[model samples]
Target chain A: MDWIAVADVVAAVLMLCGAFLVLAAGVGVARFPDLLGRMHAATKPQVLGLVLLLTGVGLRVHAWDVAGMLFLVAVFQLLTAPVAAHMVGRAGYRTGKVDTSLLALDELTPDQEAAERAAQDEADGETEQADADPR
Target chain B: MSPATPQDAGWWARWRHRMRTQWHAALWLMVVWVLLWGGVSVANVLAGTLVGFLLISVMALPSIDYRGRVRPVAALRLLGFFVRDLLVASVQVSFQALRFGWTPHGAVVRVPMRDTGDLYLTVTSVLTSLVPGTVIVEAHRITGTLYVHVLDLESSGGADAVRHHIHELEERVLRALASDDELAHAGLGPQGTAVADARAVEAMAGDVDPGAPSVTPEEDRP
Candidate 1:
């Protein structure tokens, strides 16, 4: 077979794999009960799937210019995906969408407890700092 | 009149200093410009550079704050580690999804960042989020703690493992990027107490087992 044919086959395989990953992510989001678990479903496969899809496109195109643009797409995705996930997860936590009992461990409780104690102390006129920050 | 001391040292020195501070950003913007246009040529390079300069000048881009020299060797090692984790975690999570009636005993475990600087905090959060099973839910800036939701938590001890794993990742990233002084901090040193901490937390959770049936009868009804 010619090199063009080989490249085409490889690209097809990559595209298929990428599509499968994306599908898996969708299934995960639908099945997961809580918001945090669903966030996991949302992020991991989607980012990797996008990378795979981009790679498949780049291989098929076989042009330096296209490769550069594809690389940029990958870079920007890498840069932004985690931050977006972090935000969504945080919002879920604040809004009480997360079921804490489902988790094996929770470390944020102690911090919240400490904050409550400090607030109690402030109410009792123990501390003079007016602008106490809990976060 | 300009300052008589360093600024007036020479035009060439000033130019070199400017390049040192600005070159990384300039190069990044140029690459972005090329990608946007989908081609590279002399005219594109000139236009990209001009636009980059104009944007940086007009927008007052933040100056680079050099934390430490990034060790390329360590960075490559971290990249390899991250890629490995990505593949492994994705497969693990996908399988978790495929399993019938599988309930994840996930938890929002808090990892301490009291020892790490601000940069380490950012890196740890981003890296953890990128990995499949965990995402940072909250970051307590003053105390330097991160609340991370970990998937597939099997037992109480798993919390410790998760925390230790995050610290291990942090150590790797810090080695790659943190300055000598930051690394020297005693709290940031070594992944020693990870196991011990897990055991301790497990002990603290005497009555409440993670993933045990804590739901009321009404809540339990599917």
Candidate 2:
């Protein structure tokens, strides 16, 4: 086989694999129960898939000009993806989109539990005063 | 107002500080310019540098406070370990995804990061998130904790495993990038107890004996 033909065959396989990974990510998003879960689906495989697709493109192009640009794309994707995921995950957690029952451990629970206890005690005190005053 | 005037310090000192502040950003911008135009000839490099300086003039970024010296050997070790974890975790996540509609027991595990510098925390969190099965949901700067969402919790041993794995990653990052001062700040100075404990635990875990006890002293205490 010609050298170009070999490169084309490899690139085709990589592109297909990348497509499959992206499909998996889509399925993951649809199937996951919570926002955080979906964010994982949105990030992990998709980034890898993007890398693969870019690699495929670079392989086929085989030109330094385009290859250099492709390298930038890969670097930027890597730098941005995790930061974006971190932001979305933080928002989801703060918004109470995270289901506590499914979570193995939550450090925030301690602070939340303390707040609830304080509120409960105040409510109990108010009820006691109402009962005592016969209002 | 800027603290030091041109006469307040030596000319060389002022120039060096300015160079240090702009060099990284300028170099990165130059690289991007060259890539955008294509080719690595002398003309492209020179033009790219010119454009880079122009961009830097318009947008002055804060200089990075890099405290650590780069240890290439340690960095290579961390990279090797990270790549292995990435592949293994990716495969695991893909397998879990294959089971349609099956939601693995997911949880936000809080790992302590107290006393670690901001740089270490940022580096460790980013590294941890790149692996497929875990994502950092929240990082508490005050409390020094990272709440990581881990997939496929095995009810019995999963949380502990995740915690240990994350700590190991942090240890690796510390070894790879942390300077003496940063390590000391994190209580992992050249001969710190934390690093010692981690190594001891790692050594213990490497045992291949099936008859050996699964629980270590640390696990037993907790």
Candidate 3:
């Protein structure tokens, strides 16, 4: 095959892969059991798919600077997407929207746990004194 | 001479510190944006910078205390993992799509989260959403519950497996950002067990009934 033809084939393959990835993210959003899982599906593939598609476009355009810029876009996406997800997840947690049954340890707010422990200790002390005094 | 006055001053000081940090983040984002657009034109760069600054200023209210500076290497590692996972999931999902059509058992699951700060959670959510066949529907901020839609609940290797996968993803994020002590205080580490258990329960609830119709019949139809 001529070089141009070969380039076209490669670009086509990359584009296909990118499209498939985007589709996968859509499916993941539809199929994952929870928000977190779905978010995982959405961000990762979207970033990669965009990267792949951009790479294909870059190849077709044959512009080194544009391709390099596209690479930077991918990198910035890699950096920012997680930060956004983290903020959303934390907000969800603090608001008490999370189902506790999904957790094994239930770290319950630290201050609340500490207060409970202190109350229990005081109650125990009072009971011991009452028992000793036999009132 | 008043304690309240000092407290107010302290608060403002903290606020200013946060603002400064945000400004730095804004500057970085502007640079990245400019680079991404691949324009050396002064007008484009100035406009991009202004937009970035405005965004940061508007969203400058400090909520979570993320103490450390950004670590590029850690961020890179997370990106690497995301890329790897995406490729694998893409292949697997494509096969399923081709073979079984689009209708897969779908359910919304609530996943309790460990207290790993806002940043980590945001990253986790975005990463998870990027995976094929999943979507983040709603995140309950108070309860740390993540409501997600999933495909193929029956053949999706059970809820426990899914929970495990999610936990691993979160763990990676925590390791990337927070120190051990910070993680512990955030109710991460061993305390995260509770969150994991809760996820398992939710996953079980999400198990699709085989007899029930799949959600995406149109996509699945050959």
Q: Per model, how much of the real contact set is kept?
A: 0.69, 0.53, 0.17
Instruction: Give a tens-digit lDDT track for model 3, residues B1-222.
Output: 223234457656655555665777777768777776776678877888898877766665444567644546756766787777777776766555444334445444445566556677666777787665555555544444455445444555554444446665776677577776876765555433776456445444755443444232221221
- The candidate that wins on lDDT is 1
The chain B TM-scores of all candidates, as shown, are 0.72, 0.77, 0.64
Per-residue accuracy of model 3 over A31-117 as CA lDDT, tens digit each: 654444445555656776887898788778777668768778777776676556555544554566545444322323333345457
Which model, 1 or 2, shows the larger TM-score? 1
> What DockQ does model 2 achieve?
0.31
Would you list the C-alpha lDDT of every candidate in the order shown?
0.73, 0.72, 0.60
Tens digit of per-residue lDDT, candidate 1, span B1-222: 223227447766655555556776777788799778888889888888988766655553545455666878878978988998888787778778777698877887767753665677788788888888888888776666777788777632466556656766776787788776776662444323564355335534543443554221211211
Q: How well is candidate 1 docked (DockQ)?
A: 0.56
* Better lDDT candidate (1, 2): 1
Error of 1 at B193 (Å): 18
Question: Pairing residues by index, what is the TM-score of model 1?
Answer: 0.80
Please state the error at residue A61 of candidate 3 in Å: 2.5
lDDT of 1: 0.73
Q: Top DockQ: which candidate number?
A: 1
Q: List the residue pairs that clash in candidate 2.
A: none
lDDT of 2 by residue, A24-130 (tens): 78888888777877887788877777878888998999898998999999889878888999988877766677788776565556654654676578687774322
Model 1 fnat value: 0.69
What are the per-residue Cα lDDT tens digits for candidate 2 across B17-126?
66656777889888998898888989989998988777766565655567787778878978988777766666566657778757777777656654566677788899
Give candidate 3's chain B TM-score.
0.64
